[model samples]
Target: MITTDLNIKFYTYIYKCHPHLFSSLARDGQIMGLSLRVRRRGGSGSKKEIIPVTSCSEEVEITVPSQFQCPISYELMKDPVIIASGITYDRENIEKWFESGYQTCPVTNTVLTSLEQIPNHTIRRMIQGWCGSSLGGGIERIPTPRVPVTSHQVSEICGRLSAATWRGDYAACSEMVRKLKMLGKESERNRKCVKENGAGLVLCVCLDAFSENANASILLEEIVSVLTWMLPIGSEGQTKLTTTSSFNRLVELLRNGDQNAAFVIKELLELNVAHVHALTKINGVEEAFLKSLNRDSTCVNSLTSIHHMILTNQETVSRFLELDLVNTTVEMLVDSENSVCEKALTVLNAICETKEGREKVRRNELVIPILVKKILKITEKKDLVSVMWKICKSGDGYEVEEALRLGAFKKLVVMLQVGCGEGTKEKVTELLKMMNKVMKMNGFVDRSDSSSIEFKHVKKPF
Candidate 1:
């Protein structure tokens, strides 16, 4: 038997695979309450018997009335609390909202004078009564809410964890990491409590201290796991988490660490992609990524991430090109994976926007053939076509000759006939016109009919 939550994934699968059944289920109010089973014959011949398999449909449905639901969680409230803005919410949800540094009630949008949550005893009693009544449906009754963690408690824990880390007390550090992970997992309110009380800063300190220590990988992994949940706090928090030492350590891990460490670093980079300009500042970052690519051609995630990072600024692009990334990109253009080809094309197109980049591309021997072969196969046809056109417009006679010799003109004509977007068709037509002019000037016959290429000659300076 299999059990799962009736979440968005379940609904999406049903909607996509069985739309009519989903519609009927929704009309019959069975959308919120599903129970499905698949029976198959098991064992051989005389011992054959039916075995039932259960899916997400086995989960019970809890239909809480909207009024009884917390605005933040949209679940039934256990301890309803009123705020200064005269709006009521679940104690845990509202506390998390305020602890995360919000100053207004979620519903009223009114400025709050105080963050105190006054417990609504009457509402709690009414909800309990409702849950016990016949209208409660199959939903379980709300239990008494536990008292939230105080800031003082979190600060004390941080001090101990920091001391343990600095003293090289791995055991103590691991224990604290375990406790903090538990607290973070318990509720969003607890997570905010952990962050606001310096959990993130403490974790960064531990990461810096234990990074170089021998046999510290386990401890570092624990710290990273705990820190992962405290992310995206505030700008100050982000700045502290992304300090030079910490950022470099993360990059180092990305290059050499185990799978778990690599996962943590990847996630960190993704979250702080905008703020990690320091990654580009580090020497050999591009070289290291290219080396990894050379070692493993199928690593699409690393390839895509590197391309995204390079596309962030022109300086990074220049540095990337300086590392001879153009040839590597050309190699990737022919990769069997669609994603590899697409990302390689995106980076190549970005590089072609600069004069030096265009010059380098025009000089490469494999540039034209690789692009011609992959242009129709890759999803980024527009970028590929744009790069080809730019190279053709480079005004180098040899570049134009090489492109024509490689059958680029025929590909453009085919793209036009097969029907692409109007913008793409216009660009393709212009290229064909330019290629036709060049071929005629060189005493080569324009085998492509000009009438079929339907666009006025928009002359661009060669």
Candidate 2:
């Protein structure tokens, strides 16, 4: 009787602890002679407890079947495709692997002779059927995959749009551009196909042609919309589209075109630093960019983009200086919002790299004092400190004296005492040392004077 009770206890423990394994065993008809009993305590007016006995039965375990999983992602395949090696994988993953210049099978590791991916119809039907049934574990049914656009189709669309634009077929050109936008927006693969087939070049040519004709203003907007969708494809595509004449035409459009055209120009210029520099070389481009910086609004994103582009190249900085951008940027630094101030400082940092650019900054009287005040007021201090460091490092005696006169020395000392980052602290130390040597050489300070300058705690500007 004791052996039987121990066996019953062991079976009860296994059934509770390893229910899935127990269910599998039970499903196989392996559970035998298992029973359980619980003793009841404290019955009314009873000294001894009563015991109740029960018998256990078999149950089956429901789980996801193995065939529904993809070999690539190890998850249920939403869009399964069979490769040349006769192995199935999720379509998106396989396509990405193929696009990355890998010509081998992901599973078999064998060199693939073809890149074709056939849809796995049979497995998809089975997965759909399973998802529809009660045994699917509440998994939602996967939708059918859309058919991909072919390269040949994209080429035909490009041909139609180019022909229509050349012949001045306004209605035809509009329709074709709309269709191309839809195709390009459909998927990443379609966009790649459109770019590879020379769609960006076609759009640039159309933009030039339309801009030359004064009556084609409506078509210009349409073409800009289509080109905006097709842009930022690749470096190769950007190079093909950003020709000297095309770039000049784009600058003109930015000056005269509406807000939509301005947005497109912003995106195109942001494609690379090369495009930004190229645009800067055009006449009146700097003026157009500076005019766009409005104080009463928060729409300075495009101006910031231009500033980022200018920060990358020193030649662009010199060009901006030639256009008298220093005074405008200094005014912006003093009066503009926080984000615009950050961008202005970034531009100034780059400009101060050259002697001419540094001279332009030093000549501006408001540059130093406004920058010192801004450092105190702005929460973002890294860019402001960098710009100040560049100025102090590059400035001559009069410039450094100007910085000192504007309370720059006091600000640097306070920043050090208030505990800034090691980099900022080191820069401050270097600038202070430079300033001290200059001051002593000018006979303005004596080494024996211990109380020449006093350091104070920096109070919050707010």
Candidate 3:
């Protein structure tokens, strides 16, 4: 009776403590006679296999190595990192200990001189190897851990970079900035930590201090790379960074072929263009902005910047015209994806607000066909119709004639028939009226059969 009680107690313990093994045993109908399997190497050059042993007999014990376990959790250390006190602890547990408002090391109970945790790669590799060899089929191996970086560590790195820049130590500044770039590339969490710890302000200050230094070009590029990841500074930081001097520096870097500087400036422009009240104050910025659009990665942002620039000051439109903005946007519209095409068309409409913009569109031979082609092809019918209306409304009926010849009349007729939003329908009706008037006044007959006119390229939606 005493042996039966002990067996019941053992079964209960297995069910609670090792549910996975218990489930396997129950599935195999071996719950009554408890057994455990441990993997062992068969022989040299032979395959390994699991051998079962009775739990009641001499049971094989699996013990965790003392060094492989965390000092606080006493569990196996997955991500072992050494604190400033020179004691190793798992990254997650140490972070929790710090977050609990303890400035002292959990193991030593002494004040930590610094919260910096360097990864103990040697110990981690040892643990991984032991997990692979000894634990075998019993436990899964520990994955190589991602190095954990705290905000305090990031702040220290930023401080060091700031100090290096202030002391004019370009080499040290370059090294620290590269370190930051490495950390920033490690993970998104690291990037957020860098930004939260004032990396943006520090890097911007460094750029401002060393921008004119001829020897600091490479260092400045490294700073730009790090700054690219820590984009979107807060409003207060935005107000401080988006000054005339900052604009000039970024434009110069952009002209010098640092594409990331363009990206950084793009974010800054997006954050707050309030500082950019005067467009002419910064020279060649419009040209540089237009030039960055040649690359696909920066095209969306460059278009956004141009949109904001034109809206901020209508006079900037003339500058963009001189830089071939109309031709560039027209070319982009043909190959750009839906979102980019929409933005490019929006910019064209914004440009069309002026007489020069309308004249540019009227002169471009491909403008009418491309706009009409987009009618049946693109999804945003509202923007498409809006630009067409602006063109016909501004011209001396020439654009209206060209649009009709390009089958705009048929496309619009089919669009109205298939149904569109009220706004698009209203605009399409207005365009049809303008085109019919232009055709009649130009001695061409407007017949109801135009909708039935077979189009070579556009099929009737019906």
Please, what is the whole-model Cα lDDT of each candidate in the order they appear?
A: 0.68, 0.66, 0.74
lDDT of 2 at 4: 60
Task: State model 1's lDDT.
Answer: 0.68
Per-residue C-alpha lDDT of model 1 across residues 400-442, encoded as one tens digit per residue: 6655665677778878888888777777888888878788888
Q: Which stretches of candidate 1 lie over 4 Å from their true place?
A: 1-113, 117-156, 178-198, 224-248, 257-287, 291-342, 349-386, 389-434, 439-462
Lowest summed lDDT window (length 10), candidate 3: 40-49
Candidate 3: tens digits of C-alpha lDDT, residues 1-462: 122546656766776688788678768866545444433232231432233332443335455666777878766789999999999998889978987999998877899888888999999998888867745323457899676568878889988988998999998888888888888788876887888889888888888778667677788778877777777767655644565665677777776767787677767766666655643468888888776776453367678778878877888999999888888888787667888888888889888888898788667766776787778777777777888888888777777886777678878988999899998899899999988887787766444443333334642222
The whole-model C-alpha lDDT of candidate 2 against the native structure comes to 0.66
lDDT of 2 by residue, 1-462 (tens): 223656656656766687677668657855554432222222221222111123343222233455666666555678888889998887898998998999999879999988888899888888888877766533468888765677778889889988987897878877877777787677877777777788877777676656556666677676676666566656654564566765665556556634555566677667666777676667777656655543223335455656655766556666677667777677777567788787677767767767787778777767766776775667667767776777777766675675565566667777788777888778878878876777777754322322232323322122
Candidate 2 has a TM-score of 0.59
Please give the range of 10 consecutive residues that has the lowest summed lDDT in model 2: 44-53
Per-candidate TM-score against the hidden true structure: 0.54, 0.59, 0.68
**Which ranges of candidate 2 are over 4 A from the true structure?**
1-62, 65-67, 85-87, 99-111, 120-126, 215-245, 256-283, 295-324, 331-343, 349-366, 373-407, 410-430, 437-462
Question: Best by TM-score, which number?
Answer: 3
Which should have the higher lDDT, number 1 or number 3?
A: 3
User: Where's the lowest-lDDT run of ten residues in candidate 1?
Assistant: 44-53
lDDT of 3 at 206: 81
